[model samples]
Target chain A: MRESRSDRIFYMVNNIFLFIILIIVLYPMIYIVSCSFSNPRSVTSGAVWLWPVEPTLLGYKTIFENKDILTGYTNSAYYTICGTTLAVILTVLAAYPLSRKDYALRNPIMLIFTFTMFFGGGLIPTYLLMSNLGLINTRAVMIIPGALSVYNVIVTRTYFQSTIPIELLEASQIDGCSDFTFFRKVALPLSKAIIAVIALFYAVGYWNSYFSALIYLHDREKYPLQLFLREILIQNTIDAEALSKGQMSIEDMAARQSLFELLKYSLIIVASIPVLCIYPFIQKYFVKGVMIGSLKG
Target chain B: MPDNKTYFYIKKWIDKNWQLTLMVILPLSFIILFHYVPMYGIQIAFKNYRAVDGIWGSKWVGFDHFIKFFKSYQFIRVTRNTIMLSLYSLIAGFPVPIILAIALNCCKNIKFKKTVQLVTYAPHFISVVVLMGMVIQILSPKYGLLNNLIKALGGEEVLFMAEGRYFRSIYVWSGIWQNMGFSAIIYISALSSVDPTLHEAAIVDGASRLKRVFYIDIPCIVPTIVILLILNLGSIMNVGFEKVLLLQNPTNTEYSEVISTLIYKQGLASAMPQYSYSTAIGIFNSLVNFFLIVGVNTIARKLGETSLW
Candidate 1:
């Protein structure tokens, strides 16, 4: 292929643009981490640095000292663990039957799930149902309502259907292995990629989720870290700073506003670190799995 | 005798399969209880709901809430804002990812390609609340980087969030920024499946790289694009409740108060809950999305040989 001069120039230009974009996307996160440990005063004064100046652990100390913050972390961890486990189990089991080529109910069941995706009863009925089921203000509300995501189920099913040959199942059946035994022994072992992808998706959704918790959980202890962070993040900076600092004059507050803003960024860096650390291992599978799941009819 | 034998065999199968049933039972029950049953609660949309009266016991109003919502001064404004924001997003926000995917696809440097993908996808995982916080700070009039750059260029700092006109642009564009990389993954995958032979043929025909991309690569991903478009059109009214709620202020409420926010306020925020009204609006929102999905799917199937269904 004869590559033209313009093509080379175009490639160079795009490369430069991509690098700039990379910096833009990465700098806020890097800046947030640096600012979190920097001297509170310097952070307040809008000092920009790639590295922390007069590095201090005060923000971490302060956050750790707060009982509400600790509770929020516990709640979030608990929900993520329990919700992800339940979701993965349900998703796998549901996906298994539907993945069967001879399953008479597969298409209709999938359509039923997809129907819920597009049309839902929405907030009012969902709330009513939760209250009626005695799940309101309970941890069950956080986990049960979102146990099976139709998209994840479809992804898992597609993976199984595509990867697991029907001959394997037929061979197992010839040995007098029952349907359940065949699935547990043969199909389940071969589904690690899809399972891992679905598990990560479920975990991330549970970790980042707040809407369900917001509607169902009334107790402060039940509030997840994201919801608690939401409460802090939504507050007006001057007022929040004043409240935290035990009251200050409105005139004196303007200077401290920048500090509060920095703290907000700092909190983001703090909260996002756990998931960000785990992302590289899973990123390779996510795009492939999502494409297969979404592109299917 | 044959029927009895079949029945006996079916009973035997159930007995033998009870363990698999155990694996599915709890989750299936949860789905039915939480997801499917609440769907019946759409009735409240037509009723004057009272907590004491409950759903069925509540007096039937028969589209009265819809009429009231339609007549309210805020109705047209919110609907317009939602539709326009989503439409802008659909037109502008939708194609940027396709372009980004192509750009990433064409890049020859492997290390740089991975770096770009990593950087872009990171923002998608950042919680909406946190993302909105970053937006507010970065757009702050006092020390915001955006304003600082503007001042450096001798331009005045503008309150991007407070103003009504800038809200939609910022909302839609910011959404594109947060999601562009993550959402483009699907399209990029589709691009990978494009037949290299076609590109080779185009090159032999004296087509330039850009022209080859236009003639070959873009054509291959058309079905993926069309399907994504229909899927996006289905959710045009959603407008993402969390980011809007977090970023909205009193000054911008005129333009930013969307249907979801209105429902949130009425259902949960209000001391005297108007469950019926919120229920009506929720049903109405779903119906709009449903019709959109149906309409777009039908049109795409007719025009492009692709549909979400």
Candidate 2:
């Protein structure tokens, strides 16, 4: 690997370009975190740049003081845990049989599953259906409608076809193991990598999802963190009525407004921690998940 | 005698495979209840749906709801907004990941490469609402970091979020920034799997690093790019509604009012919801997307291109 002068220049240039991209991507996120920790006055005054100025726990303290924010957190966690379980279970049940080489209805059933992806009932009809089923305003709505993802089924089926050997199934069958028993005993255990990947995928989706809850949930208490955050961020504190609910005077109103700004930054950090904290651990599996998903079986 | 013979075959199959069938029953029924039944429920678009009458029992109005949507002023606005935003995002956002993946592939420094990847990928997991919150916080004209910088630099502060003209670019570019690393994973893996022999052979022919990248790396990933493009085309009508809805204000609604948001608004946001009309508009949107996907897929298959199907 003899390097020419031009090759050296090329390497230098490439590194510089990549370095710029790294800064561009990292700065805003770093800035946001810094702002979250900064004194609220410094945050409002724009004195904080790359690092926190007059760092304090006020933003986090304020976030915890609000009962609404805590409820949002607990609700999102419940949905993530319950929804991921149901999603993974349904994906396995749908995918495993279809992955079997001996299954006569595999392709047709796959077609049915995949067809739903391209064409659907769309938003309005789906809403109507949810209401009709008594899922609207209920906890069941978030977990139920998203239980069986066709994409997850396909990904899991692909994993099964590639990883779980057909001969192993036959070997088990010779010992009087039925399909259900074999899946329960052999397949699920062997497929932990794919399951972990899929579970993380589903869990991340459940954690971040607010659109379903937005449409179905009318109860303020059932609102996911994202949806509730949407109201705080988008609605802003411009509504004097919402502000006055705290019984603030005109002077205290100004304080509430600035506090809300600090609250937004803190709330964003709080909301992101659950998914982002566990992300690194499962990230390698999900990278494998993406790799598997990209290739068709 | 034939019936008896058929029954015997059916019984044999069922006895051997009943467990598998039983396992799929609940999941299959779930799909039926949610996906298939909503599809069946789409017929409300053709009826004057009444709460008392239900979906099927309602008086059939044929294409009245459809005709009403076709004539409405909002129809043209939403369709245009949807297509423009989709194409804007697709054309602008599609290429960066390939470029990013290629550049990262060239970097010999694994530490820098991994750090860059981790940082860029973090935003993809940020919920749409929080991302929008960040957007507002950073772009707020009065106190935002962006506008404050502009003011310090002796330039007029621009309210990026509040302006209609900046809506599409803001949405699309922010989307690219958020999803670039996450999306590049596939392409990066594709580049990794490229044969080293070809690069060696090219270098032997006096190919520079850039030349090798052009000749070897790009050619290897074209099939992947094509398949991804086809998939993108398949779902081009679905500009993610969540972000648009979050970002939309009264001032920006002109540019931001897409089919999905419109449907959500018309169906749910109004005082007296236009249920049938909204459903009709939704079906029309889905049908167009369905046909576009089929058309693109057929063309790809016919041309011997690696298609999504």
Candidate 3:
């Protein structure tokens, strides 16, 4: 309970340490942003300042000039929007039915869903199932298989059960409101916080998805921006022998490698900025949602 | 009562709605088909699988793949590296968010706190591929900021990505950097729910910030810590394979060949497609994870506290 002089010094030092951590966290992102706006030569030569040295829009220009990059962005935007809408709608529908206390089958149905959170058939079965469903390579593949997340359903159902008081529902029933009417007017209106959080989660999941597209999507035309950026960054960092027994000449290889290295950091910023800009509004809700969802049953 | 009649009427209505029934039916099928069905293929580890012959037709070869894996030269190295890296991440990465949340809680400067939270949370949404690319750019021996900093500090440059010894440290620490802030948000939310009256009382008693954090803040969140730790332990086998796969080269393969990557190489990356072998390895991995979760849950139950059940 006592604050000695050393304790005061410790508190000051801790604040300073927290400040240093803040810088460590922010520096990479700031560096990437700066490099994206810098001239290519400055970026390639690693002579760019913490702020852009030349302050040019050339990097952005170069990225936009590539037709594949533009298509990739469009495809990613398309999938994220379509996918999040379907996912959220399906999740709410499924969760609402399961949240009913008097639903005779609620316990078994909930168990069936919860069982999946622990176990799975791993990747192979999932892949086979997708193919058999004839969903492979279609835009539908991006949305359908992931249309309902069990975890998201549980969170929504919990929110409905715990936060939406039974007394409110009873009052609505006394007012002669139908089940759908109560859900549409009262429940959904009260659920904006959880909905916002879940929507962000689903949006981020859809946006940052590369692994699913890697397996299910065969056509490059359908690749998301993350996959496009992935190929540019990691795919280009391969050994020559590993590629095709030295097809590339020394000079060409060197030039290609240089572009790959220079573009890597810039690409991170380009891919991340849209999602990053939206974070501040959703930031407060994310923690509350995750804690309530995670720490509770 | 009218309530009893209403309840019966609602139940009757639900029974007749086939469309609603199909909602449960369709999604339930997805889980069963995708998640439960392939569990049958786990037996392939004890069999010699033939694609044309199928799972039933595959010849039983009891313990053969397991023996082969155990005796294989890469086995000990991969297992040891995987366990060690996971354990290290658990030790170092788990508590970072807890500490960070506490630090954020102690800060009275709301502006400074929010700025720090925003900065820290940014890295989480950055994909593993991009994060690794950033890591390589910043740790490259020739031009990296870290190496340059070391040079400025009168130390030799370290090839962080190339050296096996440094690989786990880089992986774990970078992991902490990416996730600690995002993970802390939950704990911070939990901290907020702690009765402010407790903090006020401690302040009146002249409790130092460190004392308040250690005695009051941490204890308030111990249940959260325990639940998260148990869940974490449940999925220890799932090391983030994509990051490791992206970062690894032949030079660093010794330290980088975790289970998922191993499954990937066997399944899709081999000279010959060994789907059966990969499936076997994957099954082995899942079984271990299953046992680990069950074991921890049992212990939690025995300890007379929260269990997943």
Candidate 4:
């Protein structure tokens, strides 16, 4: 294709605009990383910019030393594992039955699920119900309440409908395969991509979740990483009085203050690691999940 | 008597599919217990709810809580704040992705496009707590990077989260920054599906690149845009409670107190949590969303083929 004068000018302008957008998005994230790695004084005095100055591991060292951070990490990991497993199973089960062409109650049942998506009983009643069911403050509350997403169920149902041909099911049935046997032998094996996508979706949700733990969990030991990060990250800066009443002198207090600031940047990266690491592996499926999930819409 | 054949078909269907029905039992029970039960529990909003007396045993107070909330000053404040913030977000946040998608669609460099998409979408994975923490630190009036830049430029440092005036802008824009890339995926895909032959024909007809984008590309993704806009408007009442709660100080509570956060505060944060009042507020919030989604879908159905229902 020949590049006309206007086309050339437009291309240059668009590329530059794209570059600016990139910087606008990336600068803060890079700055945070640089600050987290920098010396405490560099962070506290606003010296760090896009790159680390006097790089050190002190912030991360402190995070590792903190018993609460460790506990939160473990708890969050446990939640993610159990929650993702349960969510995938529930989604698959609910979605498969609804996806079956032979299922007579599919439309009404689908409405029953989707209606809940639009109107929930709000948080209070859900909390009350959780407490009444003896789920509040327990480990199960984190996984159970969020286990079956109607959105994922719909997405999975759409996947099964699109991918698995009805003839294959009929052939399996002719060979004396029952519905349960066919599902186990045929559908589950063929549905790996959607399963992976849904699992990744649920895992990320569980890992990044703090609100559920905020309202549900009581013990500090059971608090997720984000909640712990919230305590040190938000409360530390907001509650300066708590810092001053500590047994530290002026010099120690200043050092402690920088450490507090540095810890937040470190904790942000720490809390984000699970999702960021898994994101690349699941990037292909993630986009597919979104595409299929938007099928109805 | 005339439905004997239908009964036989029902019997056959049940006999053939009992195992399938068995497969649904676990998740069906979960939904009934967790979702339907809570929908039933919504009745507690009308009761003088006491934990000792239970939801069933509580004395009926009718619309006392709803009326009290309506009469209170916070009724106006939270509702206005919720609407304003959501509208501000809708106006500011909704268009960028469309624009970004257009830009991505035109970009000659695949590498740059992928890089931008990856980095920008990365923030969508970030938790609200952490995002709020970053927002606070970056917008801190004293030592924040933005303030430092402002001082470097001989400008006054702005107390963003602290000032009620700055709260909505900060909330809306940060939300855009977090979500725009992920949301743009739908549009980008839509744009990718746009026929290249149309662009080639426009180019042959001596159309400039900018003109081609407007004439050929923008018109192509209108359905996707409209449907997404409706979806966005549907959840207008359901703003980010975690971010608002995290960002709210005593000074900025007026601007930051959304319906969800208010419900959380009333229902759980206080020493004596007002369960019924909070439940009423929750129901009210859901009702607002219900109406908004329905209203938008109705208008959308009239205007276009794309409606949620």
lDDT top scorer: 4
Query: lDDT for every model?
Result: 0.79, 0.85, 0.77, 0.86
| Per-residue lDDT of model 2, residues A21-101, tens digit only | 888888888888998998777888888788999888777876776777778889989998999999899899988998897
Q: Per-residue lDDT of A1-297 in model 1, one digit per residue for the tens? A: 557898888788878877777887788777777877876666655565578878876566555555666787888888888988989989998888777766655666666766777777788788898888899999888877777887788788888888789988888878999777888888888877777788888888888887888888899888998887887666542234333542223355554564465556667777787778878888887766777666563
What TM-score would every model get versus the actual structure? 0.92, 0.95, 0.89, 0.94
Residue B168 displacement (Å), model 1: 1.5
| Per-residue lDDT of model 2, residues B197-263, tens digit only | 9988888998888888888999999998988888898888898898999889999999999999998
Each candidate's fnat: 0.53, 0.66, 0.34, 0.61
Comparing chain B with the reference, what is the TM-score for each candidate? 0.93, 0.95, 0.89, 0.94
Ranking by TM-score: 2, 4, 1, 3
Predicted candidate 3 versus true structure: per-residue lDDT over B240-292, tens digit per residue = 88788778877788888898888777766678867666666777788888899
Q: What does DockQ come to for candidate 1?
A: 0.54
Which structure is stronger by DockQ: 2 or 4? 2
Lowest lDDT sum, 10 consecutive residues, model 1 chain B, at B16-25
Model 2: residues with Cα > 4 Å off, grouped in runs: A238-254, B1-8
Model 2's i-RMS, to one decimal, reads 1.4
The TM-score of the first chain in every model comes to 0.88, 0.91, 0.87, 0.91
As for candidate 1, its interface RMSD to one decimal place is: 2.2
Clashing pairs in 1: none
lDDT score, candidate 4, position A191: 86
Top-scoring candidate (TM-score): 2
**Weakest 10 consecutive residues of candidate 2 chain B by summed lDDT:** B16-25
Q: Show the lowest summed lDDT stretch of 10 residues, model 4 chain A.
A: A241-250
Off by over 4 Å in 4: A237-251, B1-7
